[model samples]
Target: MALLETLAVVFAVALVAAVAVYIKTKLFPLGDGEEIREDVAEYISMMVSVFYALVLGLCLVSVWDNRATADDRVQAEASALHQTYLLADALPAEQRGPVREAARSYAGHVVDVEWPLMAEREPLGDDGWTLLDRLRTAGELRGPGTTAQQIAAQEVLAQIGYVDDARRGREAAAEERLSVVLWAGLVIGGVLTVAFMFLFGLNRSSTHVILVMGLSGFIAFTVLLIHQLDTPFGDPLGVGPDPFTRYFRL
Candidate 1:
């Protein structure tokens, strides 16, 4: 639904701009004496488009890499937590329940609480780390009595270490954002690219409308794509709780 609405809006804007440009050409046809060289105009338009494409490609790559990093961190964190959960069964009977409960609580907190904060780009409190500390404490409360229990406890601690490292990465990724200068360039370059095409339009009226509208629509779509990718944690683009649900059944 969101995609449909966005496409409709972009197409509408492109249609309107094409109509306006077409009307302008009819109202003020270029005089023979005022006409610029067609080759020069085409060269200028091509350069503007190339420069704009460079900026667009940079922005797209920046956001896409950030999004991929965020997803990777999520996968690592969930995997480590799942390892922690599995190691609990090897723990002493009394310690097993607390450790499992701690793992479940940690998973729930991430999915139910921390995820929303990330989606909103909100500052995360230390509560998540605190839960991690609790999990560590829960697992380490009693010393392992047997050699097997010792190995299990040590492995569990190592997995928790992985979870902590991945959590840090996730936090960093959540704060990732595209630079303001790039965004300014994106907007200005798009406007200039479209404006140049409008200025040096085609001779055929129908062809002019088609060409201009197609360029306009494609540019609009690119801008929208950049914006969507910029918000790696937000809806319509973000990876959800699938990793957690897969392992912990959250």
Candidate 2:
């Protein structure tokens, strides 16, 4: 589901549950001296809250790190491609143009073709690999080239290798996500935390309702944030093709 829709559903459900509980409490008021031990329930609730907070923190940190790493990979790949394009200037005239052209084509393909696929969590076809191979072939140094040309060829190969590594890292990061068990824990934990709030009898129903609404909304927001970060290439929050665009002027 879309992020906004998911959030609306979560908050709506939470509101409905809170209201239903409030109504039940009103119809079946607790008799005098029948209240549970407030101190013990408070302590238990506090502990649960702390545990759930820690889980949420861990999830946030993990996804943020993944997103950062994905961005770094993109920058590194673009930089390597840029360097390869520049280094081609030192190649023998016969070899130089093809190398530069191949590098440019590869970068353009990444920005135009592969990026959209990544956002959709789709596999990149062999087109990119073909372009990279063309780049590598263009940089191949045959026997008896000028010393400067040889050095440029070697540097181009090195840069291409860097691009390969960074592309792999980018693809891996794109596929990375929080485990299903962790998601289950997050959902269940949030529900329990909100349910625990109902255990405490508030003096005013209005105050109780307000508190539940606020807490539920906050929890829903946090979950939505995590979901956005879960897919590093997802819309709006996902990393863009800015690196390639900046380096290639495309």
Candidate 3:
């Protein structure tokens, strides 16, 4: 959703909540002790606060899980590519150099070229896929030599397949984000929860201000935290190319 639209929705929610509470207070003044339905208000406020907290927790968990999955994809891709590099040693002498170079080129492309693209949520193009295909071709060119060589070649192909799968997953994760509905829930829930605090009549104005300040600040912090973590390969809580660097020593 657009920023202005989101802000408008939040404002409307808070305004409605404030108007409702004001009417309730006016109809059943706590000071007059006219059978005040404070119990109902209290129940409602507690429920809003709890559900706001629950929504915050759910968003946090969702982002954290997405980040973890992205990290796993990176690790799996790097590990499989590393294994492919190692398996190059088992190929026949003529095939060894080509296979090793292909593996190195692919790893370098990932670390130097593709990592930045993923971080920026940009398309990586077919360069990566082409590189992977080259690695497969290099392994295939072994031309059915010895038994051990054949087995190693098979293993190399398997590792390349693993790398391909992980790369696809990584790409998918880069474009992933928190749902707009969840974002709306977060904002509306937070506003309502804070707004409900106004329903209660505190003896001390300072106490009310302090309580509102703390609650609003906490809600803002959590929402911002979730926003930062929403992108699988973006800032503060993003998955990095450290796995590739670690595996390939890039």
Candidate 4:
């Protein structure tokens, strides 16, 4: 839906600019084929195009890095939970069952409940945090009977800590997004870039129209790409629940 809206806006702008340019040429026309006007237009167009390209490149890099970080967080969280699940074997028999169960339950909640919410950019609610708390409590085994048990308990605590930290990071990443200011810049910059295309004088009407259409389409596509990447949990290009599924078999 968002992509469609962006495309519509870009197309509308391009069509309006093209029509306006065509009408201007028919009515007013160029003055005595002035070389100065063409020179000035060419210089301004070149400068604007360069600046716009830089802005687009920066936006792309920012969003790409964010998406990559989000993926890494998901992997880290899933791996930590998997480690905690395995460490349960070293825990006292009484503690092992509950700890392992809690770990499994947490992974299930993340894959089934939290993932959908993240994709929608919605809050995950207290349920996920509650599950994490349960996992933490289950691992709080005080003073084991033997040195080996004590060592195992410490390892369990460490793994659980890692899980807690990674879950927090994952939640943060899910909520991450481009700022409104950056969005404004993207839209305004795209408009200016397309509008500048009209300033340059072209002898062939067909060539001018084609250039406008191609430029508009490319801008719209780039904006759509940034939007999709802005929300790492968004569909198609989004990070999936594969890490959790692989570890928990959910």
Tell me each candidate's TM-score: 0.83, 0.84, 0.84, 0.83
Candidate 3 lDDT over residue span 21-46, tens digit each: 89977896667546646798889888
* Model 2: residues with Cα > 4 Å off, grouped in runs: 1-36
Scored by lDDT, model 4 comes in at: 0.85
Candidates 2 and 3 compared by lDDT, better number:
2
lDDT by residue (tens digit), candidate 4, 157-223: 7877787787788888888888655676688788889998887768999999999999999999999
lDDT at 23 for candidate 4?
A: 98
Alpha carbon lDDT of each predicted model:
0.87, 0.89, 0.86, 0.85
**Once superposed on the true structure, which residue ranges of model 1 sit more than 4 Å away at CA?**
1-38
Root-mean-square deviation of each candidate, in angstroms? 8.6, 7.1, 3.9, 6.5
What is the C-alpha lDDT profile of model 1 across 82-144, one tens digit per residue?
999999988899999889899999999999998999999999899899999999997773753
Ranking by lDDT: 2, 1, 3, 4
Please name the candidate that would achieve the greatest lDDT relative to the true structure: 2
Candidate 3 regions with alpha-carbon error over 4 angstroms: 1-34
